[model samples]
Target: MTEILLLNGEPLHTVTPQLLRATSYAHFSSLQVRDGKVDGLDLHFERLDRSTRELFGRSLEAAQIRAVLQAGLAHTDGNASFRLTVLDTDLLLRIEPPIAPSTTPVRLQPIQHQRALPHLKHTGTFDLIYFGRRAQEAGYDDAVFHTAAGEISEASIWNICFARGPEIVFPAAPILNGIRQQVLQRGLAAYETSPVLVSELASFDAAYLTNSIDPALPVAAIGEVTYAPHPESVRTIAAAYASQAAQPI
Candidate 1:
């Protein structure tokens, strides 16, 4: 679980003096590397490419990016979490032991804040972390965000999904379109995107959260509206996600 940081192909320490005051204008992706294999590696690469273009006004060479990821992963084994960051032209890859989110059901607190550029996975360290900690202190597992109009967008680090009988529904507002969500969309038979109002949490049968590392985690409650964890739907989506073959990066 030791820290392994790499810039481009060269190794760097976590406390590198230059990184201490680094600007926050960066795009990144968080993925799980198990036994040197990665799930949705292609989608992860696509995300980096899209963000690089949108944020930096240029494209990152694919072979170069792959080489950098390979270089960083050389120092790790077993399950681990990897975060690839692009700050200007510098490609930063940090690897640590895998940190899985809670498997148990979680409660979410609604926060009325929306990201400026919801599509790109840019550096949102301050507001997301602050609000997450605030929610934790207030006895919630995490915070879900909504627009001023009460349209649910996403969570601090996860995408929200709703179960309406046998179908799956996602919030139609702007979101990061997470890699895990993409994989699920490919595997699930019935899913649609619609406006999920924050004030209308009780209308759904069940809810769940998805991110890069975890497949599907059931939601227990949001604010005061409690939901009985729907294990069948969660298992179906989880199995479909697990069936996705991991590729070497």
Candidate 2:
């Protein structure tokens, strides 16, 4: 489906080259809205605010951002995905059909690269799409990115988490702290944060991917290392994430 773009919550069909180029300097948050409610809505706004301050040296009010998102949500129906971008004083919203969360497992190809300013959700479409395409061409569903130092960071579009018996371990490397990942971390009991290394994939019993649209997607393999997709630990983490309450936009 084609996306609907809105500037300051108003319908926008034509974009100037200047504004298009502005996307490179923008900070964005990808989120899912269901029936006008979004899980981790506050966290999403907080992320935008933090990124905006760090990247553009500007402060963003959560209430104002919520108003803008609410207006954009009015143009869509049911479950929809929104990419809210802040370019200086302007707010751009891209509304599109929601991605169906997969119950099926997926394989990941490791890529030796790290994101600049790993904490902010800045535009890295080129790197993500390019590396992701390379992975898909290699017969993998997605790509997992790591530092040249051999630290496993995150996936192209999701945060990677590992299941180790009774606990869940998140990669402590610098990466985009996804809203869904935050929700799971806060909701789950047996969760720990640690640096994950490429050589350590075999040490974990299971693995999964988490993001705004997907609550939890099991990982079948990472290169040659295989994992049990639907482990009990993964199920527990997924259930914990699912139990989070949705906040109004």
Model 1: clashing residue pairs? none
lDDT of each: 0.84, 0.87
Clashing pairs in 2: none
Tell me each candidate's TM-score: 0.93, 0.95
Worst ten in a row by lDDT for model 2? 229-238
Tens-digit lDDT string for candidate 1 (1-249)? 788888787887555666654546788988888877787888888888888888889988778788987887777775788898888788888888887766788899999988878888888668889899999999999999999999999999899999877678999989989998998888787688999998898999899889976678888999999999676776768766767788787
Displacement of residue 7 (Cα, Å) in model 1 is 1.3
Highest-TM-score candidate: 2
lDDT of 2 at 16: 98
Worst 10 residues of 1 by lDDT: 14-23
Candidate 1 local lDDT, residue 51? 84
Q: What local lDDT score does residue 53 receive in model 2, on the 0 to 100 scale?
A: 86
How far residue 90's Cα lies from its native spot in candidate 2, in Å, is 0.4
Candidate 2, superposed: residue stretches over 4 Å from native:
none
